[model samples]
Target chain A: EDQVTQSPEALRLQEGESSSLNCSYTVSGLRGLFWYRQDPGKGPEFLFTLYSAGEEKEKERLKATLTKKESFLHITAPKPEDSATYLCAVQAGAGANSKLTFGKGITLSVRP
Target chain B: EAGVTQFPSHSVIEKGQTVTLRCDPISGHDNLYWYRRVMGKEIKFLLHFVKESKQDESGMPNNRFLAERTGGTYSTLKVQPAELEDSGVYFCASSRSSNQPQHFGDGTRLSIL
Candidate 1:
């Protein structure tokens, strides 16, 4: 069975603090890994997509890195406005119909 | 271009009742997807449509659920005889291509009494 697990169900950091959230998975094949940020009462906003191990993508203060079995979303000097639930999802097949399997997500709180 | 949009941001109905949720995908997007998340659970895929055709629906729970994308545009999901376990957040997403990242809507919160 394909499954995705996000570690540290919740994380709190000071305004300038930096940390990383982990997402581990077990899938038949890794087509792509997606990262999203969801604010309260809103849908998830697309962040990054990593297709291979050792790949990294960055946007503003957030950076996403991928590995064979896991992915990490690293936040640098996060601000309060950056607080949101971070979700990690994986596509299991290389085909067009590949379904997405998502993790429970990690809730982040950045205190200013 | 607008993002995916879902209607009836929240729906409350009694068990055994029928509820319909709608989703309008981004303009020119050919791939639309439906997902649901129950309390304390990760979001689960329900179905996928590509240009009014059902590409995959293996994640659909049962026969009571039906999804349609009319005219290769907006889509609708109808749940008949809703059960208590059916209460959850239903999200709609769309993408231009299979390999592209999906954009999501605000989602509809369904409650079955």
Candidate 2:
């Protein structure tokens, strides 16, 4: 079974602080790795999709980087509004088997 | 474009009662998915629909859950005789294609007492 494990189940940071969240995975053949941000009582919002190792994507203060075995979401100078649960999911195989196996998620709280 | 939307932002019910959740995917999206996040657990895929067809449903926990996407425009998931363990957030997501990024709705929070 494809599995995703996210580190630091809960994190607290001061406004403008920078840190990175880690996601480690094991799959038969990784088709894609996804990053999502979820707020309290809300569904997850897509962030980035990493298809191959050494690939990276950025949006505002968030930068997502991937490797063969893990992925990292780096938040640069985060604001209080950035507080949310960061989810990491992995899709294995292809075609109709596009289901995503998600991790438990990392809860981030940024204090102003 | 409008994002995916789900009805009943919150629902509270007693055990053994039936509840039906609805979802309206973004226009032009062909792939619809159902997922659930139980408390203290990861979000898990329940099933997927492609243009009104059941493409994959390997993750469905049991026969108590039934999902349908008639006409391929909207979808519904019904849980009969709901159990206490069924309390959680049920989310709906849609994608343009199989490999595209899936967009999610705000989710329906179900609480069984």
Strongest candidate by DockQ: 2
> Which regions of candidate 2 fall more than 4 Å away from where they truly are?
none
TM-score of chain A of 2: 0.98
Per-residue lDDT tens digits for candidate 1, residues A4-97, read 9999999999999999999999988898999999998789899999999999999999999999999999999999999899999999865666
Measured against the true structure, the TM-scores of the candidates, in listed sequence, are: 0.98, 0.98
- Residue-by-residue lDDT tens digits, candidate 2, A1-112: 8889999999999999999999999999899999999998888999999999999999999999999999999999999999999999999985578888999999999999
Give the least accurate 10-residue stretch of model 2 chain A, judged by summed lDDT: A91-100
On lDDT, the candidate that comes out on top is 2
lDDT of each: 0.94, 0.95
